[model samples]
Target: MIEIIAISEAHVESFHRALDTVARERRYLAFLEAPPLAATRSFVLDMIAQRNPQFVALSGGDVVGWCDVQRLSRPIHAHGGILGMGLLQPFRGQGLGTRLIRHTLDAARAAGMSRVELSVHENNANAIALYKKVGFVIEGLQRNANKIDGVYGNVILMALLF
Candidate 1:
Protein backbone atom coordinates (compact mmCIF):
# COMPACT_ATOMS: atom_id res chain seq x y z
CA MET A 1 0.00 0.00 0.00
CA ILE A 2 1.20 3.50 -0.82
CA GLU A 3 0.64 6.37 1.58
CA ILE A 4 1.28 10.10 1.38
CA ILE A 5 1.99 11.94 4.60
CA ALA A 6 3.05 15.37 5.76
CA ILE A 7 6.83 15.54 6.09
CA SER A 8 8.04 15.58 9.67
CA GLU A 9 11.43 15.72 11.35
CA ALA A 10 11.33 11.99 11.80
CA HIS A 11 11.09 11.53 8.03
CA VAL A 12 14.05 13.71 7.19
CA GLU A 13 16.57 10.89 7.04
CA SER A 14 14.35 8.78 4.88
CA PHE A 15 13.60 11.72 2.61
CA HIS A 16 17.29 12.38 2.20
CA ARG A 17 17.93 8.76 1.36
CA ALA A 18 15.15 8.77 -1.21
CA LEU A 19 16.48 11.95 -2.79
CA ASP A 20 19.92 10.43 -3.18
CA THR A 21 18.46 7.44 -4.95
CA VAL A 22 16.42 9.63 -7.28
CA ALA A 23 19.40 11.80 -8.04
CA ARG A 24 21.62 8.86 -8.80
CA GLU A 25 19.23 6.88 -10.93
CA ARG A 26 17.28 9.55 -12.75
CA ARG A 27 20.23 11.84 -13.35
CA TYR A 28 17.60 14.47 -12.45
CA LEU A 29 20.17 16.97 -11.39
CA ALA A 30 20.11 19.38 -14.26
CA PHE A 31 20.37 22.14 -11.70
CA LEU A 32 22.29 20.36 -8.97
CA GLU A 33 24.49 17.37 -8.65
CA ALA A 34 23.57 15.26 -5.69
CA PRO A 35 25.21 17.36 -3.03
CA PRO A 36 27.24 15.88 -0.23
CA LEU A 37 24.82 13.58 1.57
CA ALA A 38 24.84 15.80 4.63
CA ALA A 39 24.15 18.92 2.60
CA THR A 40 21.19 17.33 0.87
CA ARG A 41 19.86 16.42 4.28
CA SER A 42 20.23 19.96 5.56
CA PHE A 43 18.71 21.51 2.45
CA VAL A 44 15.48 19.59 2.87
CA LEU A 45 15.36 20.25 6.58
CA ASP A 46 15.85 23.97 6.01
CA MET A 47 13.23 24.11 3.29
CA ILE A 48 10.73 22.44 5.60
CA ALA A 49 11.78 24.78 8.39
CA GLN A 50 10.73 27.70 6.23
CA ARG A 51 7.13 26.40 6.41
CA ASN A 52 6.63 25.09 2.90
CA PRO A 53 5.12 21.68 3.27
CA GLN A 54 6.77 18.54 1.90
CA PHE A 55 5.14 15.18 1.39
CA VAL A 56 6.53 11.75 0.80
CA ALA A 57 4.81 8.77 -0.78
CA LEU A 58 5.67 5.70 1.17
CA SER A 59 5.10 2.13 0.05
CA GLY A 60 5.35 -0.32 2.88
CA GLY A 61 7.49 2.08 4.87
CA ASP A 62 9.99 2.90 2.13
CA VAL A 63 10.06 6.40 0.69
CA VAL A 64 9.30 6.13 -2.99
CA GLY A 65 8.69 9.70 -4.06
CA TRP A 66 8.26 13.33 -2.99
CA CYS A 67 6.91 16.65 -4.23
CA ASP A 68 7.22 20.11 -2.78
CA VAL A 69 5.75 23.52 -3.59
CA GLN A 70 8.66 25.83 -2.96
CA ARG A 71 7.00 28.92 -1.55
CA LEU A 72 7.30 32.51 -2.72
CA SER A 73 9.39 32.28 -5.89
CA ARG A 74 10.48 35.88 -5.80
CA PRO A 75 9.46 39.53 -5.30
CA ILE A 76 7.85 39.83 -8.72
CA HIS A 77 6.52 36.28 -8.69
CA ALA A 78 5.26 36.27 -5.14
CA HIS A 79 1.84 35.00 -6.08
CA GLY A 80 3.30 32.03 -7.89
CA GLY A 81 4.65 28.82 -6.42
CA ILE A 82 7.43 26.74 -7.94
CA LEU A 83 7.66 22.98 -7.71
CA GLY A 84 10.25 20.19 -7.71
CA MET A 85 8.82 16.71 -8.04
CA GLY A 86 10.36 13.28 -8.47
CA LEU A 87 9.72 9.58 -8.04
CA LEU A 88 11.94 6.54 -8.06
CA GLN A 89 12.40 5.13 -11.56
CA PRO A 90 10.84 1.78 -10.81
CA PHE A 91 7.70 3.54 -9.57
CA ARG A 92 7.25 5.74 -12.65
CA GLY A 93 4.50 3.98 -14.62
CA GLN A 94 2.07 3.61 -11.75
CA GLY A 95 -0.40 6.34 -10.68
CA LEU A 96 1.92 7.60 -7.94
CA GLY A 97 2.92 10.66 -9.94
CA THR A 98 -0.69 11.70 -10.30
CA ARG A 99 -1.34 11.32 -6.61
CA LEU A 100 1.80 13.23 -5.65
CA ILE A 101 1.05 16.11 -7.99
CA ARG A 102 -2.56 16.31 -6.88
CA HIS A 103 -1.43 16.49 -3.31
CA THR A 104 0.88 19.39 -4.15
CA LEU A 105 -1.87 21.21 -6.01
CA ASP A 106 -4.15 20.89 -3.02
CA ALA A 107 -1.40 22.36 -0.87
CA ALA A 108 -0.98 25.24 -3.30
CA ARG A 109 -4.68 25.94 -3.17
CA ALA A 110 -4.59 25.94 0.61
CA ALA A 111 -1.67 28.36 0.53
CA GLY A 112 -3.86 30.76 -1.48
CA MET A 113 -1.81 30.53 -4.62
CA SER A 114 -3.69 31.52 -7.75
CA ARG A 115 -1.07 29.88 -9.94
CA VAL A 116 1.64 27.24 -9.86
CA GLU A 117 4.52 26.83 -12.27
CA LEU A 118 7.43 24.55 -13.04
CA SER A 119 10.23 24.26 -15.56
CA VAL A 120 10.85 20.88 -17.10
CA HIS A 121 13.73 20.03 -19.32
CA GLU A 122 12.32 19.78 -22.83
CA ASN A 123 13.65 16.28 -23.14
CA ASN A 124 11.97 14.80 -20.09
CA ALA A 125 9.04 13.16 -21.82
CA ASN A 126 7.63 11.34 -18.84
CA ALA A 127 7.54 14.45 -16.71
CA ILE A 128 5.93 16.43 -19.50
CA ALA A 129 3.29 13.78 -19.90
CA LEU A 130 2.62 13.58 -16.21
CA TYR A 131 2.37 17.37 -15.86
CA LYS A 132 -0.10 17.51 -18.70
CA LYS A 133 -2.01 14.65 -17.17
CA VAL A 134 -2.45 16.78 -14.06
CA GLY A 135 -3.76 19.85 -15.95
CA PHE A 136 -0.59 21.87 -16.23
CA VAL A 137 -0.33 23.47 -19.64
CA ILE A 138 2.78 24.63 -21.37
CA GLU A 139 3.05 28.39 -21.15
CA GLY A 140 6.21 28.68 -23.28
CA LEU A 141 9.64 27.30 -23.88
CA GLN A 142 12.74 29.02 -22.64
CA ARG A 143 15.42 28.61 -25.25
CA ASN A 144 18.86 27.77 -23.98
CA ALA A 145 17.56 28.24 -20.46
CA ASN A 146 19.86 25.87 -18.63
CA LYS A 147 23.23 24.22 -19.05
CA ILE A 148 23.42 20.57 -18.23
CA ASP A 149 26.78 18.84 -18.46
CA GLY A 150 28.04 21.58 -20.81
CA VAL A 151 25.11 21.29 -23.18
CA TYR A 152 22.34 23.87 -23.29
CA GLY A 153 18.89 22.47 -22.66
CA ASN A 154 15.61 24.20 -23.31
CA VAL A 155 13.21 24.51 -20.43
CA ILE A 156 9.51 24.05 -21.01
CA LEU A 157 7.58 26.42 -18.82
CA MET A 158 4.43 24.77 -17.51
CA ALA A 159 1.68 26.23 -15.36
CA LEU A 160 -1.53 25.33 -13.57
CA LEU A 161 -4.02 28.04 -12.69
CA PHE A 162 -6.29 27.61 -9.74
Candidate 2:
Protein backbone atom coordinates (compact mmCIF):
# COMPACT_ATOMS: atom_id res chain seq x y z
CA MET A 1 0.00 0.00 0.00
CA ILE A 2 1.15 3.49 -0.76
CA GLU A 3 1.12 6.16 1.92
CA ILE A 4 0.76 9.87 1.35
CA ILE A 5 2.53 11.74 4.10
CA ALA A 6 4.09 15.07 4.86
CA ILE A 7 7.76 15.24 3.88
CA SER A 8 10.38 15.35 6.58
CA GLU A 9 14.14 15.50 6.54
CA ALA A 10 14.29 11.74 6.52
CA HIS A 11 12.37 11.60 3.28
CA VAL A 12 14.46 14.15 1.42
CA GLU A 13 16.80 11.76 -0.36
CA SER A 14 14.03 9.54 -1.67
CA PHE A 15 11.98 12.55 -2.67
CA HIS A 16 14.95 13.89 -4.57
CA ARG A 17 15.28 10.65 -6.42
CA ALA A 18 11.63 10.63 -7.37
CA LEU A 19 11.87 14.23 -8.50
CA ASP A 20 14.87 13.43 -10.67
CA THR A 21 13.09 10.49 -12.23
CA VAL A 22 10.10 12.60 -13.21
CA ALA A 23 12.07 15.60 -14.30
CA ARG A 24 14.32 13.44 -16.50
CA GLU A 25 11.23 12.38 -18.40
CA ARG A 26 11.40 15.89 -19.97
CA ARG A 27 7.68 15.82 -20.56
CA TYR A 28 6.10 17.33 -17.43
CA LEU A 29 8.10 19.61 -15.16
CA ALA A 30 9.97 22.65 -16.40
CA PHE A 31 13.09 21.05 -14.94
CA LEU A 32 14.96 18.81 -17.34
CA GLU A 33 16.53 17.21 -14.30
CA ALA A 34 16.35 17.63 -10.56
CA PRO A 35 18.65 20.14 -9.02
CA PRO A 36 21.79 19.05 -7.21
CA LEU A 37 21.10 17.11 -4.04
CA ALA A 38 22.35 19.90 -1.84
CA ALA A 39 20.03 22.38 -3.50
CA THR A 40 17.05 20.10 -3.24
CA ARG A 41 17.86 19.48 0.39
CA SER A 42 18.09 23.18 1.08
CA PHE A 43 14.82 23.88 -0.71
CA VAL A 44 13.00 21.20 1.19
CA LEU A 45 14.43 22.40 4.44
CA ASP A 46 13.38 25.95 3.69
CA MET A 47 9.89 24.81 2.81
CA ILE A 48 9.68 23.04 6.13
CA ALA A 49 11.03 26.04 7.93
CA GLN A 50 8.42 28.23 6.30
CA ARG A 51 5.66 25.78 7.07
CA ASN A 52 4.80 25.39 3.40
CA PRO A 53 2.94 22.28 2.40
CA GLN A 54 5.02 19.43 0.96
CA PHE A 55 3.95 15.84 0.82
CA VAL A 56 5.28 12.64 -0.66
CA ALA A 57 3.77 9.40 -1.78
CA LEU A 58 5.71 6.47 -0.50
CA SER A 59 5.64 2.88 -1.66
CA GLY A 60 7.77 0.33 0.12
CA GLY A 61 9.72 3.14 1.76
CA ASP A 62 10.58 4.88 -1.50
CA VAL A 63 9.11 8.11 -2.71
CA VAL A 64 6.97 7.53 -5.76
CA GLY A 65 5.42 10.98 -6.05
CA TRP A 66 5.17 14.40 -4.40
CA CYS A 67 3.06 17.55 -4.19
CA ASP A 68 3.99 20.92 -2.80
CA VAL A 69 2.83 24.52 -2.59
CA GLN A 70 5.39 27.22 -2.08
CA ARG A 71 4.09 30.54 -0.95
CA LEU A 72 5.67 33.68 -2.35
CA SER A 73 8.14 35.20 0.03
CA ARG A 74 7.21 38.82 -0.53
CA PRO A 75 4.69 40.05 2.01
CA ILE A 76 2.19 41.22 -0.57
CA HIS A 77 2.28 37.89 -2.39
CA ALA A 78 2.30 35.74 0.70
CA HIS A 79 -1.34 34.97 0.24
CA GLY A 80 -0.53 33.11 -2.92
CA GLY A 81 1.48 30.00 -3.70
CA ILE A 82 2.69 28.03 -6.68
CA LEU A 83 1.61 24.42 -6.76
CA GLY A 84 3.71 21.60 -8.20
CA MET A 85 3.29 17.86 -8.31
CA GLY A 86 4.40 14.71 -10.11
CA LEU A 87 4.09 10.94 -9.98
CA LEU A 88 6.42 8.26 -11.12
CA GLN A 89 5.45 6.76 -14.48
CA PRO A 90 4.20 3.60 -12.89
CA PHE A 91 2.11 5.52 -10.38
CA ARG A 92 0.17 7.61 -12.87
CA GLY A 93 -3.50 7.06 -13.79
CA GLN A 94 -4.31 5.35 -10.53
CA GLY A 95 -5.76 8.41 -8.69
CA LEU A 96 -2.54 8.91 -6.70
CA GLY A 97 -2.05 12.37 -8.14
CA THR A 98 -5.50 13.34 -7.03
CA ARG A 99 -4.83 12.13 -3.53
CA LEU A 100 -1.45 13.79 -3.25
CA ILE A 101 -2.70 17.13 -4.56
CA ARG A 102 -5.76 17.13 -2.38
CA HIS A 103 -3.68 16.49 0.68
CA THR A 104 -1.24 19.26 -0.15
CA LEU A 105 -3.92 21.77 -1.06
CA ASP A 106 -5.73 21.10 2.14
CA ALA A 107 -2.57 21.91 4.01
CA ALA A 108 -2.14 25.07 1.98
CA ARG A 109 -5.65 26.20 2.75
CA ALA A 110 -5.17 25.54 6.41
CA ALA A 111 -1.98 27.56 6.33
CA GLY A 112 -3.96 30.62 5.14
CA MET A 113 -3.06 30.76 1.48
CA SER A 114 -5.74 32.42 -0.61
CA ARG A 115 -4.67 31.31 -4.05
CA VAL A 116 -2.69 28.59 -5.74
CA GLU A 117 -1.33 28.72 -9.25
CA LEU A 118 0.51 26.44 -11.67
CA SER A 119 1.73 26.28 -15.23
CA VAL A 120 1.37 23.12 -17.24
CA HIS A 121 2.59 22.13 -20.64
CA GLU A 122 -0.32 22.28 -23.09
CA ASN A 123 0.13 18.72 -24.26
CA ASN A 124 -0.29 17.28 -20.76
CA ALA A 125 -3.99 16.59 -21.02
CA ASN A 126 -4.18 14.30 -18.06
CA ALA A 127 -2.57 16.83 -15.75
CA ILE A 128 -4.77 19.62 -17.10
CA ALA A 129 -7.86 17.54 -16.52
CA LEU A 130 -6.76 16.64 -13.02
CA TYR A 131 -6.13 20.27 -12.19
CA LYS A 132 -9.60 21.18 -13.40
CA LYS A 133 -11.11 18.39 -11.39
CA VAL A 134 -9.48 19.86 -8.30
CA GLY A 135 -11.10 23.27 -8.95
CA PHE A 136 -8.17 24.93 -10.72
CA VAL A 137 -9.20 27.01 -13.73
CA ILE A 138 -7.18 28.06 -16.70
CA GLU A 139 -6.21 31.68 -16.20
CA GLY A 140 -4.17 32.33 -19.35
CA LEU A 141 -1.91 30.83 -21.96
CA GLN A 142 1.67 31.75 -22.72
CA ARG A 143 2.69 31.31 -26.32
CA ASN A 144 5.81 29.25 -26.86
CA ALA A 145 6.62 29.44 -23.22
CA ASN A 146 8.58 26.23 -23.12
CA LYS A 147 11.19 24.89 -25.51
CA ILE A 148 12.49 21.37 -25.13
CA ASP A 149 14.71 19.47 -27.48
CA GLY A 150 14.26 22.10 -30.19
CA VAL A 151 10.48 21.97 -29.87
CA TYR A 152 8.33 24.77 -28.54
CA GLY A 153 5.22 24.28 -26.45
CA ASN A 154 2.56 26.56 -25.05
CA VAL A 155 2.01 26.82 -21.32
CA ILE A 156 -1.39 26.92 -19.73
CA LEU A 157 -1.52 28.96 -16.57
CA MET A 158 -4.05 27.86 -14.00
CA ALA A 159 -5.13 29.10 -10.61
CA LEU A 160 -7.46 28.25 -7.80
CA LEU A 161 -8.80 30.88 -5.45
CA PHE A 162 -9.75 30.01 -1.91
Evaluated with TM-score, which candidate comes out highest?
2
| Candidate 2 per-residue lDDT over residues 90-132, each given as its tens digit | 9999999999999999999999999999999999999999999
Q: Estimate each model's TM-score.
A: 0.85, 0.99
lDDT, residue 52, candidate 2: 99
Evaluated at residue 150, the lDDT of candidate 2 is 96
TM-score, cand. 1 vs. native = 0.85
Q: lDDT of each model, Cα atoms only? A: 0.80, 0.97
Scored by Cα lDDT, where does model 2 land?
A: 0.97
Residue 85 in model 2: lDDT = 96
Give candidates' CA RMSD values in order: 2.2, 0.5
Summarize candidate 1's per-residue lDDT along 48-94 as a digit string, tens digits.
Answer: 77666578898778788988887775777777788888887888889
* Highest-lDDT candidate: 2
lDDT of 1 at 144: 89
